[model samples]
Structures are given as C-alpha cells and as structure tokens.
Target: MFEALYQYQGQLLQGLTTTLIVAFGSFVVGFLIAAVLAPAAVYGNLLTRRIIMGYVGLIRGLPELLVIFLIFYGGTVLLTKLAGRYVEVDALTAGIASLSVVSAAYLTEILRSALLSVAQGQWEAALSLGFRRPRAFLLVVLQQMMVKALPGLTNQWLVILKESALVSVIGLEELMRKSVVAAGATHQPLAFYLAAAGFYVIITGISTLLLKAYETRLTPHMR
Candidate 1:
C-alpha cells in the first residue's frame, strides 16, 4: 500500500486539491445561504417561515445521492429547456450545488438553535434602550450565536468534506475519483482506498484541532 501510494504521490496531491476546492466552494456557499435561511425561518412572517420549513423538510426527506442526481441531471435538463439552448453543467458546479443544499439544511438548524439559545433578557434590554429588535439582534445576538454554532457547524463541515467523495459518480476528478482511477490502473484497490481514507483522516484531524482552538477562543469554558 505504501509503495503504491509513493508511486502515485502526484495523483494523490491532485485529488486532494480538487477535493478541498469542492469542499470549500460548497461549505462557503452553504453557510451563506444558511445564514439567511435560519434568520428568515425564525423572524420572517408566517408565509416565509412556512416556505423555509417546507424546504428544510423536503431536503431532510431525500437521500443525499438522490439530491445530487436531481440537481445535476435535472438542472441540465431544465436549463436547456428554459433557455431553448443546450446547457451542460460541469461536474464541479453540480457537485457544489448538491452538497451546498444538503449542508444548508443542517447549518440552518444549527444557526437557528444557537440564536434561540441567547437569553430573552438581552433582547429586551436592547429594546428598552431604544434599539430596534432587528438592529439589536444583529449587533448583539448574531455574534453570540456564531460562537455557539461554530462547533456544530464545524462538524457539519467535516460531513460535507467526506460527502464530496460522492461526486465521483458525476465524473468529478476529486479525491475518490482519482483514487478509483489509480486503483484500477495499479490493480491495488485496497492500497489506493486506504490511501484515500488516510487523506481524509489527515484533513479531518487537522480540522478538529483548529475547531477546538477556535471554540476555546470563542468560549473560555471550552479551554
């Protein structure tokens, strides 16, 4: 296994890079969408809240792979039809969109829970001092919610990272896909897969340390 890994070192690095790119793209986009979604679900009017809730419910009900297929293949069809021109989506674009949607559902819940965890007293205090509710929430509650949400969100981050492997089905040249190619070429399935798993372990291990450090910074009790 080790010899095979050494021989295919360049492929491993390339795969790692693509994996990170896909993960980063999905995570960033998902977090931004979730930031809006959580707040809208809580504070928006009944219709808006219901709409957001329905979206979350729908996503939760579906398998992740199904979601990816729907977005990738479905988007291509819809785009081509709507535009009256053939439109093809690249694997990366489809993968990012699919993963971001899944991540957003979890992130929305994490953020909403964090926001609700803040004391009502603080909200009232700000209102009593003449700050509008929205302004107060933004100025005070948002920061606290982010701090509280970080640990859970980071766990979700790792989930999305691992899930990116599923994009191999779409022909994305990410870590898993690269590993598959190498394994086929070298006839060392176990060795190549073990190497891929090790790469993921390294990424997650480093991420865990960073998350811990950030958590300690945000909440001293974590130390």
Candidate 2:
C-alpha cells in the first residue's frame, strides 16, 4: 500500500517540516502572550481584567478554523488597504498567527488558574524581603506558576499540533495537504491517509512521553 508513498518521501518530509514549524511557532507565541495576559488578568484593575477575560471568552467560543480563515483572508485585505497595493498574507504566517492567537486564549486561562493557585503569602514574603513587586513575581511567583501550568501547557501543545493540520485548507502545504496530493495522484487514499494519521500519532505520542518525563522531573514530590 505504501509502495507509491515511497516516491513522495521528500514531499511528505517537507510537509512534516512545515507542520512542526507551525506548531512550535504557535506554541512559543501563545506562551508569550499568555505569560503577559495571564498576570494582567489576575493582577490588573477591574477594567483590564474584564477586557482580558472578554478576549479569552471570545476566542475560546469561536471555531479554530474560523479564526484561521478570518486571519488569512482578512489580513490580506487589511494589509492591501494599508499598503495601497496588492498585499497578500503568507499562508505560513497566517497559520502561525491564527493558531497562536487561539492557543493564547486557552493558555491564558490555564496560566491564570496556575497563578491563582500560588499562595498570597508568597507575594507577601517576597515584599518583606524588599524585592519589588515585579521582581518578586518574576523570580518567585512566576516560576511556581509555570511549574503548575506545565501539564496544561503540554496538552495545549498537543492540541495545537493537531490543529496545525487545519492550515492545510489555506494551502500551507503541511502534512495533511501533502497526503491529499499524494493520495490523489497515487490513487491510494488509504495508504497516504493512514500514513498521515500515523505521522500525527507518532509525533503526539513522542511529545507526550517527553513532556511527561519533564513534568516528573519538575515535580518530583508529586511523583
């Protein structure tokens, strides 16, 4: 069944590279956004908290595919108007931006919960030591929050890994798109499709194992 798949090895690998790039890019960007927004949501004034919560609610309620479409299409139009010429958003850029935005929403909630889990006494103790609020939060509280948030973030990474496939619809040439093309040309849909599924499973499986090990090391008492 995979006989014909052999010829497309290079293409499939290239597609897999794109898939990894999108997933990693989205996760890194999402983590950064969540790092900032999570604290603001937890520590900021009422209006700031409300605004951040509203954004989280809005993005979480929307479909991921819909977000991708809006960014991919809407971004092109907006950029074209701004540049006063034909400006098209790159598919890869759109994939990363949309997924990262969506991922950030969920990550913010995860991190917010983690942040809240931290004891108020920890902050007080840091302040007693003459450390500034930002320093205390960064050096002490944030570290604990990240440790608490690790499992949720790991699962979110897997979610984004799978979600990256949706970018195929926008022509980013990720694994799914490559499989479709290969199956259509080779007339072995099962072979190519199964291969794609297997690829995803392998990547997610490896990721889970690695993250779990890291989690264990981080929280040895829990283990």
Extract clashing residue pairs from model 2: none
Name the candidate that leads on lDDT.
2
Q: Report how far off residue 30 is in candidate 2 (Å).
A: 0.9
lDDT tens digits by residue: candidate 1, 1-223? 7788889989889989999998989999999999999999888999998998888888988988999999999999999999999998889999999999998888888998998898888898889989998899889888889898998999998999999999989899999999999999899999999889999999999999999888888888656
Model-by-model lDDT, in order?
A: 0.91, 0.95
lDDT of 2 by residue, 48-162 (tens): 9999999999999999999999999999999999999989999999999999999999999999999999999999999999999999999989888888999899999999999
The total of clashing pairs for model 1 equals 0
Worst 10 residues of 2 by lDDT: 1-10
Stretches of candidate 2 off by over 4 Å are none
TM-score of each predicted structure versus truth:
0.94, 0.96
